[model samples]
Target: MPQLKGIKILLVDDEPNILRFLEIGLQNEGFEVLTAQDGLSAITLVKQFQPHIVILDVMMPGMDGFEICRMLKKTENLAVIMLTAKEEVEDRVKGLNLGADDYMVKPFSFDELLARIHARIRNHFPNMWGEVVAGPFRIDDRRKEISYEDKVLELSPTEYELLKFMAINNGLVLSKAMILDKVWGYDFNGEENIVEVYIRSLREKLNDREHRLIRTLRGSGYRIDVQ
Candidate 1:
């Protein structure tokens, strides 16, 4: 339902019917859509179009969706959604671990796919302006940067989202479900352990010998309290 006008989306699928279907659906929503039938063409369109979002099919003939997702993630602020025919948990997790923003299995509803695309764009580029501070940590929503004291942390897209959510809530104790919903969006059908994976990744990047930024509560979830 978000205003998608001028938002470019690249659809990469070998099936011409699928590509046409999605292109029409997205175009109807006021998005500028580009189509690619293979990984090589996807990469070329990516460089040329520099789309804000990409809907990629997993099982292409050469250069699978996973490889393309990994490559495209190197771009600073691009969002990716992987589409797979298989409903395996391993496939979903692998895609997410490889930095895909979200994934959908085949036969997914057009409405749901549109919602996911909107959610990804919304989460990545929040409307908030200026910086938020919690003790020694500062999160600049406009800049998409997080700093501890005077040093900035090099965090991935997922890591930055998780950390920013916690930082916004500050000392509040956030349940795993709440964090998952806020950070990963309601479309994420993966296990709660995905939250743990991102938390561990954030902890590693926020490693400070004297101060702990994220605190875990037994039987509860996590809280960010900078001292």
Candidate 2:
């Protein structure tokens, strides 16, 4: 819905049928789709295609999606959505921690997947163009980067989105549900603990022990208070 045309998307899966199905489906949606059957090939295609978003499948024969997500994170501005057959929370958390922007279990609805893809694209490429400053923290929307005190913080895709969203609404108590709807999108069907997991990760990156940028509100939620 958000001008998906000409946006490059890479699909990585071991199943030939799955690859073909997703390719056709995405192509029909006006996305420029590419396919890879393994992690190694996926990496190669990513380099060549320079896709804006990658739909990666876990449990490949060789490199695996986790490793691929890590590799891709090194590239600036590439959004990754992982596909996994395992429904375990650990797997989902692992992917998010490894820098995946989102993940969908196997046998997932194509429509839901498309919605996630759109949401991720919109989050990563917001219309606003400028730097958001709150105390020592800064979010450069144009560059898609965040900095703390003058030093740039190395953040995963999900962490970056969460931080940016909070920074935009600095000092406001944002509930977990509000965060899920804003950062993860309204259609997210994953566990709410996912928010806790990412918050822990963000706090670590922000060095909150000393700076105390993100504060937890016991009964409410969390807020970014740059004091």
- Best candidate (score: lDDT): 2
Q: What C-alpha lDDT does candidate 1 achieve relative to the native structure?
A: 0.82
lDDT of each: 0.82, 0.84
Q: With candidate 1 superimposed using the best TM-score fit, by how many Å does residue 197's alpha carbon deviate from the native?
A: 42
Give every collision pair in model 2: none
Model 1 residue 97 distance off true place after TM-score fit, in angstroms: 0.8
Q: Which regions of candidate 2 are displaced past 4 Å?
A: 1-3, 127-227
Model 1 agreement with the true structure over 100-166: per-residue lDDT tens digits:
9999999999877976886777687555224655666677767788887868999888888888778
* TM-score for each of the candidates: 0.56, 0.56
lDDT of 2: 0.84
